[model samples]
Target: MQKLKDRVAIITGGAQGIGAAYARAMAAEGARVAIADILDGTSLAKEIEAAGGRAMAVQVNVADETSVLAMAEAVNEHFGRIDILVNNAAVYASLQLKPFSEIDVAEWDKVMAVNVRGPFVCAKAVVPFMRSNGYGRIVNISSGTPFKGTPNLLHYVTSKGAILALSRALAREVGGDGICVNTLAPGLVLSEGVIQNTDMREKLTGPVLASRAIKRDQTPEDLIEPLLFLASDACAFMTGETLVVDGGSVMH
Candidate 1:
């Protein structure tokens, strides 16, 4: 459990939900974590401290290269090294299932900016630090809907698809450097941003339990153990793998 003793980690979009869970789990396992998100990461850091673990809050907008770079610098300056990174920040558009013709270009671009470019920039910023240190662990979060093709969330679905592939390619590129990169694709996790709206909940979950073998519903807590497994010493030999933790709902 203390395999990550004194190891510093960066978890983007780590202020709440699954990201928050990972932050706490990593800290519990002796990793000093930096909760990086556009949202003030103060509360998450405080929680870690309350639990007797070390943590810091770094404000980062993953879509912006400057913000991502500065976050990496701040984490390094505070912790002296970065041993792990979990790219978990994400966003969804309000637009519904429509003909591709009716979809707004601006909305599609917004999704790409955050979902795709954000992780890329964050990875680019931290890899150099990891390279010099000779060890790194990265877990990029994605959704399973893309693999099954959700009709409504075109933007959200496609972006996750891209992240899955990106994690694999990135793994192959950096494996020799002792960096293990992988993707954690979660299903219908209930988060603050998600369940707040009735419409959003209905849309995200309608196809989830109905088509799956399991009759149980999934919550944000469902993913904590898996997140811990990858962020800790357990994932050293696992790279370029998409660990689907969707309760057998979506098989790829």
Candidate 2:
């Protein structure tokens, strides 16, 4: 059965990498997906439609309230309802790993804007639509690095930690309205973006693999089922929960 049959889902950063994986997974489950991203996602949307799944691409800077609001409007207009939101847009692969002291102030703010404020603005833009429908699912993408206290990327780790707090607080505020907010924390996966960054892939992969109980590289496919559960009716009774899917690395 199609878990998300007829549901409308908005996936930020859907143009590439893990976000693209989420888009494909949701589309395959019968959701009409809106691929929202600062990058061009038109090709991916076309690809999904060609595969008999419904999708549309919309350009959006998740950190900008106006841009995010416009994106929500576009999706609502095209799909007629907003059922789920995957807050997956972030600044990670592009970052050059460095000690906290060496991190530039401007870079730190940029990371916070996209990693933290992005989700906040996105949720703000879409909540009214979800509230009107009396139903919604918000899956905020966080990371396992924060729990492990991973160094050399303090800003990235801190922003991901904020997502946990954001999910819980938002879940509490929206629970009565039948809106579910949760966090999905994934370990380092060799996504398209990560693969292109040789520094990130080469430096972190071996150590991350050693840390995992599974003792294998995590893939985008590894996250599909967990994402489906959170975005579908299967997770109706659950909110404010952090479902970590990092191959049992950080058993939180």
Candidate 3:
């Protein structure tokens, strides 16, 4: 069954990495996907359309309220309705792995702005349209590092922790409007960015694999099913929840 048939989904950071994977999977499942990102998503959107799916690429800076609101308006104008929002944009790929005290405050603030405020802005911008349609799905992308208190990336971890709380609180505020909100926390996924950075990949995935019950590399593809379930009508009754997809690393 096409779980997302006729749905319109906006995947922030959908130009590459795990967000791109989500855009593709959602498009395959019959959703009209909008690949919104700071980077150009034109090619990916064209790829989806070429493969018999409906998609559009929009440039957006999730951290900026004006940009987010403009993105929501553009998407709504094109698709006629907004059904799902996948908050996947963050400042992780270029993050410097440094000790807590060594990390600069400006860098910390940047991470917070993108990783935390970005989702908040996106939700606020998309809510009115979702309320108008009488249904919506919001899936915020978080990281498992916060749960494990992973070191060397304090700002990144801290920002992700806020995402879980954000998802919970936002869910409560929007549940009455028929909008279900949840968080999808993934482990060390060997996405395009990670795979391209061999040193970073080895440094992160080594600890993850050692702790994981399933001893294999986690990929962006591994997250597709959970994302789909959250975005589908099947999850209407579920909200304010966090699903940690980390191969049994953190059992909580």
Candidate 4:
């Protein structure tokens, strides 16, 4: 039997890249997936449906509380309940890599809004539903950068670190309600966004691979199972944990 049968999952930033992969995987596991993103995920939703999976596209700015509330309502209205939330939306793709001292205040604020506040807003909007239903799984997407103290991406790293903290605290608060909150920190994945960033690809690829004990490129496919496990009943006893999926690069 499918792990997520009859479940309804909301995957933020699901239009493309890792988020898209999550949506597809969850849908395949028998969940009704809601693809929420600032960009249009209509085509991806259609593709999931074409592949005999259940899905819907919701255009949303995760940083906006109003948008997040509406997204939660829409998912609830369509699926009757929200069983899982993958807080995967963030402002990473178009980030301009530069020294911390050189980074603009505005740029830092934008990163915080999306990478940190986005999850905060999403959790606030969705938690009540989960609480009311007495079951929910929240998987916040963090990063491995913070573990390595990765350079030239202070804002991104700091924002992801905040996610880790949020999950830990939120897990404690919601455990009584049968809700679980955990963070998934992925390493330098060779995602579409990463691959398309010619500068980033050229600059960090070699060092990233060599640093990993696996010594191979990490892809979105590599993360699907871990994601599913956290979102499934199999992880019912687990919460307030950070699962690092960084190819053994940062073991702690």
lDDT of 4 by residue, 75-138 (tens): 9999999999999998886776789999899999999999999999999999999999999999
Q: By summed lDDT, which 10 consecutive residues of candidate 1 come out lowest?
A: 92-101
Where is model 2 more than 4 Å wrong at Cα?
A: none
* Candidate lDDT values, in order: 0.86, 0.96, 0.94, 0.93
Give the alpha carbon lDDT tens digit for every residue of 1-252 in model 1.
386798898999888767888888889889999999988989889989998999999998999999999999999999999989899988862445565666688988988999999999999999999999899999899988877887767888889999988998999999999999988888776776676756767766777878767767777778877877777678999999988888888887
Please state the error at residue 180 of candidate 2 in Å. 0.5
Task: Assess every candidate by TM-score.
Answer: 0.94, 0.99, 0.98, 0.98
Find the number of clashing residue pairs for candidate 4: 0
**Model 1 off-target regions past 4 Å?**
93-99
Ranking by TM-score: 2, 4, 3, 1
TM-score of 4: 0.98
- How close is each model in CA RMSD to the real structure? 1.6, 0.6, 0.8, 0.8
Please write out the lDDT profile of model 3 over residues 1-252, one tens digit for every residue.
899999999999999999999999999999999999999999999999999999999999999999999999999999999999999999887775778999998999999999999999999999999999899999999989888999999999999999999999999999999999999999988888777776677688778899999999998989999999999998989999999998999888
TM-score attained by model 2:
0.99
Candidate 2 residues 192-221, lDDT tens each?
A: 889999998888998899898999988999
Give the local distance difference test score of model 2. 0.96
